[model samples]
Target: MDSLRAAIVDGRNTAADDDQFIERLAQLQHEHGPMVCRSIFQTLAGIDLPRDTAEDYWRQVLYRRQQLSRILGRNVDLMTAMCDFLRSETRYLPHPRLVEVDSFERIVYESMYDGLTGLFNRLYFDEAFAHQISLAKRYNTDLSVLFLDVDDFKTINDTHGHIVGDVALKKIGAIIKKTKRDSDLAARYGGEEFVLLMPHTESINAFILADRIRQEVEKEEFTAHDLTYRLTVSGGLASCPLNATEPADLLHMADSATYMAKGSGKNTICLFKKDKRRYLRVKLMQPVLIKEMGFNDSQAYEGKSKNIGIGGILFENDTPLPVGAHVQVSITGRNNAPLLLIGTIVRIESFGPNSYDIGMAFSFKEMEKIATAEIAQFLKEGA
Candidate 1:
């Protein structure tokens, strides 16, 4: 019981010995999961070990690790590592087999990490997203997720070959690891796509971080054989309890924002803002016949639908419609049946003479009478 206290107490052991103990503890925790204070602590108090004493002992260990981390380098995020270990261990129901299962650390690592980039895999990311969202909701803290995708990655693969593409992905992964805070999580959401979970972070900070990563990606040069190429990334930022209240909603919003950045032109960062009137617009190409309602006795006008959302539709029309005009739009559904929707003109843009783009917000008050669900689902799926 006196060994650990004697080893760490003032003038009892050399600094080198202290370093070795801390390193060993970290390694042991990694291989066999978290260690209880009884396993690491040797006290000189000669008092009985209280059931509540482990937490205080753990705090001491973490305090020492914090100091060691500063001395060792920025490569380690002690608090983050500690949090991960604690979170993992606490989730396990106490059992001898459960402990043995946790000890199979290599299997867990392989399952949770992406084989290609060594970042958190999609499965692990889903778990993290849920965990972070729950914490954010319970504590009312700011949490943001960043969705990033390499710009024109398919072109890179086609031009340089898949080998070159692999190299680029690995390089980008390294950059993400280097750039992100230790407390933040980097995950490979899918092919050429990455997501970051930033705990206790605001949208502005997340945007700045995303921009920094975008700039870094843009400036990075990759060499494959005799050819050198540069790449860029597009990013989207969405915050919890702000842009969305659920994990799926948050992810969708971030993805929608990323799509928006791609649409605006790549190599940019976009922040997701919940639209008061619109959910998300999905690009669709369909011919529509529009008739002006109320006070208009004119002929029906033809327009091409650009995008459709639950809240509105953007379409190109040769005839300019007044912003306040009420109209009826008829379009063919996926089932080849004509679907009708009533909307109010909300926006208009002219690209050339006799060519105008119009935006209309559907009046949802009467949408129940129409089969809009099937049409919306088709558009959303296509989008």
Candidate 2:
């Protein structure tokens, strides 16, 4: 204690010596604990610690030291910083014996999270979305939005009662929390609808996450009235700078895509694809062999094309494929010659008990000219 007072009064130590002294002081404080240091400060300087908690007191001490160093144009010791803080007009010194009963933190948590889902509520989500959009724009980073809706949610409520529906929603919320990244923000937007905001993520990656949640929801079983049933969800994905930069526009795009997913039949994930060319979609019902890119030939599925266009193809298959899967579609071109088109499965909808309608968006990066020419020719001939 005397050595510390002498060192502070001398005040002739070099910068290196001061740093070493501060390090040793921190080591002593860590070893002996903050209460001992607080007692020492009170006995030596005759002033209370500036904050209620020991951690807060130490934090304020370091923060005030930085401020004093900047103002005085030189490094200052802990005692000097503490004395300056005690003399400051804006110091936050609370009564040591006063215990706070009403925790502001608990109130804030109640306001931010939903009562049932335990996820962020709509109000908090809106605020967080706006803040994240600002950060993404400032940092030139990517932001993705996922909009999801429960399929046949009203039916669940009407049939099994609202209690079952609520349980299903809670389960879905748990699935989302498990599937999404820690950095992602998820919120219950309203009844049976949820939204997720992903920072520094692309649209494709966001689609993968949304699809995983969809699969999990589909696999989850809900029980009520001595019966058990399954549920599914449809989702839509959009990204910043790729779809729209404005928050409202991006959300609208994702919602529109979600509506498209619902219209395409349900239990699907659709990416917001802006139709740049307004390609003519023609009805072309023909048998096509569908093969997932990363799978073997034995796993190939057969489906019939319902519509063909320059941008994409819609087909019905007995098997369902996940969204964001690369696929090769083989169809009979002019003169019955085999024409293979490389594409991606962007949407999947349950058509019947054993049938699914798959939407494949063409990827021209592999065979641009050939696939374009074949699709153009096929559409012209069909027309």
Candidate 3:
């Protein structure tokens, strides 16, 4: 309940958006609303808020659901979180001190894009490009653009349909996102085409990245509608400082390169520069789950952590495990005992599938002395 209240305090989740919360929650469990509610109530009790206050909060949410049901003339599932929160004692609490309203609005707006594919609707790309160009000119950094077209898109679209095309786009977008560092942005230009804006990345990097994206596309296979299709992408690579002095000119140069790549051949990656880095990076996130005992009544039995990093932990799912149950995980990867952390699932996220993703503050003072750092380094370096 404290985290729930804190999230409300943060202004991202609200009792007002009860319906949306229910929808997102349902993604995790279809028929476990009651079980979910009980777990949530139990978890709420462990928080800083008084038990009576928390129960009152829950009661108010139920009352609100009843009132809403009367107004809307329908039965509201009182067990689900949003409905419960509507009746929660904290529902009427003072608003949070968040100052950045526009940031939330921007995040809501960005969620519309295919994050895996990096495609903006035709509408968003224009504005974003303009914004980047403006920033580049203000900062006096070199700005370059690369427009890419996947070769044989129609043939793939015809043979495997739009699903395969989408898969290809997503895979290619991920490749570019991994290829470029934090300074660069790539957007789905449209269809099987993508546009990249490189801030301060020289023409050499732009051309190399374009070629890499193309080669990356060329190497992947798309499976859709039960058929696998070998897919390749063609790119037109252009840049600033060499081909053009302005953003507009750079965009034009890159677009013409796309035209040239298609003209030259369908399955090749063309570059605006002859020299560039040729290494390809493939990224994959690891999932971690928890161990269940022979006898226990814990709400969640397992968790998952995504992308464990150098200095900290990466938790994706959560669960509650009592001592003696033992935390058991099953990951199919290159063989190794990944990381040896000393802490257990202390706190967890209760949102989805009744699974907890706990945050672990490492207790090992010297992980290398304990071989924890060795395992972490091995997985990171072995990769």
Q: How accurate locally, in lDDT, is each candidate?
A: 0.72, 0.76, 0.54
Rank by TM-score (best first): 2, 1, 3
Looking at candidate 1, the ten consecutive residues that score lowest on lDDT are 1-10
Q: What value does the lDDT take at residue 43 in candidate 2?
A: 36
lDDT of 1 at 191: 91
* lDDT (tens digit, per residue) of candidate 1 on 7-63: 223222233554464565555446433322443432212123443565465665467
Considering every candidate listed, which one attains the maximal lDDT? Answer: 2
Of the two candidates 2 and 3, the one with more favorable lDDT, higher being better, is 2
Q: Cα deviation of 361 in candidate 3 (Å)?
A: 48
- Clash counts per candidate, in order, are 0, 0, 17
Which residue pairs in candidate 1 collide?
A: none
Q: If scored against the real structure, what TM-score would every candidate get?
A: 0.48, 0.56, 0.42
Off by over 4 Å in 1: 1-103, 276-383
Q: What is candidate 1's CA lDDT for residue 248? A: 97
Q: Which model scores highest in TM-score? A: 2
